[model samples]
Target: MLDDITELNENTTFVEEAKTIDEEDLYPFPTSEDEPTTKRFLGMTPAQLFVISIEFFFMVLIFGVFFMIVTERMTIPF
Candidate 1:
């Protein structure tokens, strides 16, 4: 075990650290203004738009049924 430990230590090598460090180099910020824009309306993803459509469908369904009842188009049997 001791011989194996010494052999491992002898095989290891050290790397020198950088001589100079810059703040800008650490964190790079892009300065380009020509980034591509998404084609989705109001920046909503397809899944989000689908969920909104489903909610709108239910809203219209409920309101339509209520309107029919108010106008005597549909009657309650009870």
Candidate 2:
């Protein structure tokens, strides 16, 4: 019984340490120097805007398809 309790405590400690390491890796706190600077939309190049627009359109199309699927409005004909 004592061996079992010791094993359980060791397992718990290992799990807690692993969790802490994983959390640190997943979300290392950003430093102040890593912060983004404010930029105006007018500063964006035409190519950047075009890429953004395309991404937005693609996202909207994906959402539309998802909505249709979830609503059971999508159909297949054999």
Candidate 3:
């Protein structure tokens, strides 16, 4: 059932290779086969990153405000 869903979703898997590089060794460059040339942030464009950052900032600001309000209420005398 999961395989069917993954196939329908156009999800493909690739095998990743690991490389060992020593500092003293002259050749330390990663091979092309081991290094996958894929853009990870392709989905997150500049505008999207900006918008997400603003949204996260506002969320943190709202949470901080709520926390401060609660703390103040708890500290005040009845």
Candidate 4:
């Protein structure tokens, strides 16, 4: 009394046609499909913002290490 709810043994083959180079293609992108768009936030793109964030993070880290060394918080093991 079981219905045909299980489709685990179905054979579905996808046939793809061979693509040829077309002279009429305005932007013949063979490998990449991503298009760069002018999207910005606060006069900076997401990538730019990411770089700035990384730079600021490193700056804070360097300053923190410098502060620790200057304040003599940790002893030099030598």
Query: Which one is best on TM-score?
Result: 1
Better of 3 and 4 by TM-score: 4
lDDT of 1 by residue, 1-78 (tens): 234544554433433122244646765774344444556777889999999999999999999999999999998779
Candidate 3 wrong stretches, greater than 4 Å? 1-42, 73-78
Per-residue lDDT value at 3 in model 1:
44
- Of candidate 3, the 10-residue stretch with the lowest lDDT total is 12-21
Q: Per-residue lDDT of 1-78 in model 2, one digit per residue for the tens?
A: 234654565545755656656545776887666666865477897789999999999999999998988898995455
Q: Local distance difference test, per candidate?
A: 0.70, 0.73, 0.63, 0.64
Error of 4 at 59 (Å): 0.2
Model 4 bad stretches (over 4 Å)? 1-39, 76-78
Query: Judged by TM-score relative to the true structure, which candidate is superior, 1 or 2?
Result: 1
Q: Lowest summed lDDT over 10 consecutive residues: which window, candidate 2?
A: 1-10
Q: Could you tell me how far off, in angstroms, the CA of residue 57 lies in candidate 3 after the best superposition?
A: 0.2
**Model 1 misplaced regions, further than 4 Å:** 1-37
Of the pair 1 and 3, which is ahead by TM-score? 1
**CA RMSD per model (angstroms):** 9.6, 13.9, 16.6, 12.1
TM per candidate:
0.52, 0.43, 0.42, 0.45
Candidate 2: misplaced stretches above 4 Å?
A: 1-40, 76-78
Q: Candidate 2's error at 72, in angstroms?
A: 0.7
